[model samples]
Target: MVAGGGMGPDDEGISFAHALATLKEQGSALLVVGSVPEELFAKASRTMLGDPDADPPRRRLVVTPEPNPESAVRRLRETGPLSAEYARVISRGERARSAAVADSFDEMTPRTHVVDDSIRGLGTTIADVIEEFDLFAGGLEPAEFRMAFDCLPTVLATHGREVAFRFLHVVIAQARSVSGLVHFRLPRAVDSEAVGLFEPLFDATVELQVDGDDLHQRWHFRDRDITSDWLPVGDRP
Candidate 1:
């Protein structure tokens, strides 16, 4: 039985269509297919020939298989049988590593493990991590969440907003991942709306609602829409 795989996600899969396309790329070609189903032999003898065993008038019969176990084994044992003529493939393994490998190929993109570790190591509560990384929501104590939150900025800085946010959808463990509307309350008085705004790559919906003596506005990322529960941006501001 056919088991396992050997195709990458980018390659899609091995199919007759892809094989044909590869041939066309090389130039002129002709594909010949043959199968020895019982019905064809009977039909050819009766319809084309006046007699059951008679040969057809304008046709040549080139029997590909002699109806024997040896031929079947020979036909099936294909590793690179037609490598020069019609390229044959044995197996393909599929994996979701294309985006990651391609992204980091030129040293431009970060690795998958780097991203995964970044999120998981975020010092937030274990509950928060289980929520984000594990994609499950649970009650975590304040101290633990604070522990997890400590790693937020470093994680964001290293990962960047693009991949960071996509992963944060699971790693954030709170409303912040999607529509939770969270940010750092910059104590220095920057727009709270501007917390995760270092790069426009991340579609952060947080809006800063800075108010009086909020000179400490730079300390936390305030939600412009609400004046309550504004979290610290980097455990600092």
Candidate 2:
């Protein structure tokens, strides 16, 4: 059975806040799989990171293959406060390295770590950075940390399924060890075969769809073998 059965929906559908709270209460690290439009994903990421002003502030890490760290920071800031210690950005690849260096002048921007793809593979670089972040926390509880890996498709495209699978295996173990909530975004529609290939790595899979101005999501819990009804993405509580 799922650890938190009370989170199951009624006839009316589930609220965004209730779903998030249940996930946190599940007491183990979660690997949530999902893909959505970029804008909606960003909003969901912000929600998952929690309110900056909320109690027991969380440490956030964003790993992106995008070239512009500034643009990422700007998008994050659109939702809530982003402090240097509260959040860190890992800019991956050659282009990102250049962009991160150029954007280093702003103290207000989240600290960016540039990982050059030429020197190290994506899996190694991500693992190393996550280790460093963990070490830097120095005894902070794992639940205090959250990570958003924004480029699974890019990783798969660059390294192929076998390599991406190996990378995810290691990274998911890392997240579970720390008891952190970490999510990887695919950003595009994938066939069932592909989903089946990656489904075992995650605790839950969230499928998202857009219809006109309404955004909806459905959740699947692997361990309990339960799938949620499609619920509208509402404002964060």
RMSD of each: 31.7, 4.2
Q: Pick the candidate with the highest TM-score.
A: 2
lDDT of 2 by residue, 1-237 (tens): 133446544522444445555556542333334555677777666665656665556667787878675546854564344665566788776787776677678666777777765324556665665666567667446456677787677778878899888788888787667667777776544346667788788777767777677777667666664566666765432
Candidate no. 2 TM-score:
0.79
What would the per-residue lDDT of candidate 1 be over residues 1-237, giving only the tens digit for each residue?
Answer: 111244344333333234323322321111111222333222221221122121111111111112121221122122112111111111111221343344345332212211224344332333232344222214322211111111234445566765555544543334333222122211112333324344132222222232342311111112111121342222210
Positional deviation of residue 119's Cα in model 1 after best superposition, in angstroms? 3.4
Off by over 4 Å in 2: 1-22, 25-35, 78-83, 118-121, 234-237
Candidate 2 overall Cα lDDT vs. reference?
A: 0.65
lDDT of each: 0.25, 0.65
- Candidate 2: how large is its RMSD? 4.2
**Model 1 accuracy (lDDT, Cα):** 0.25
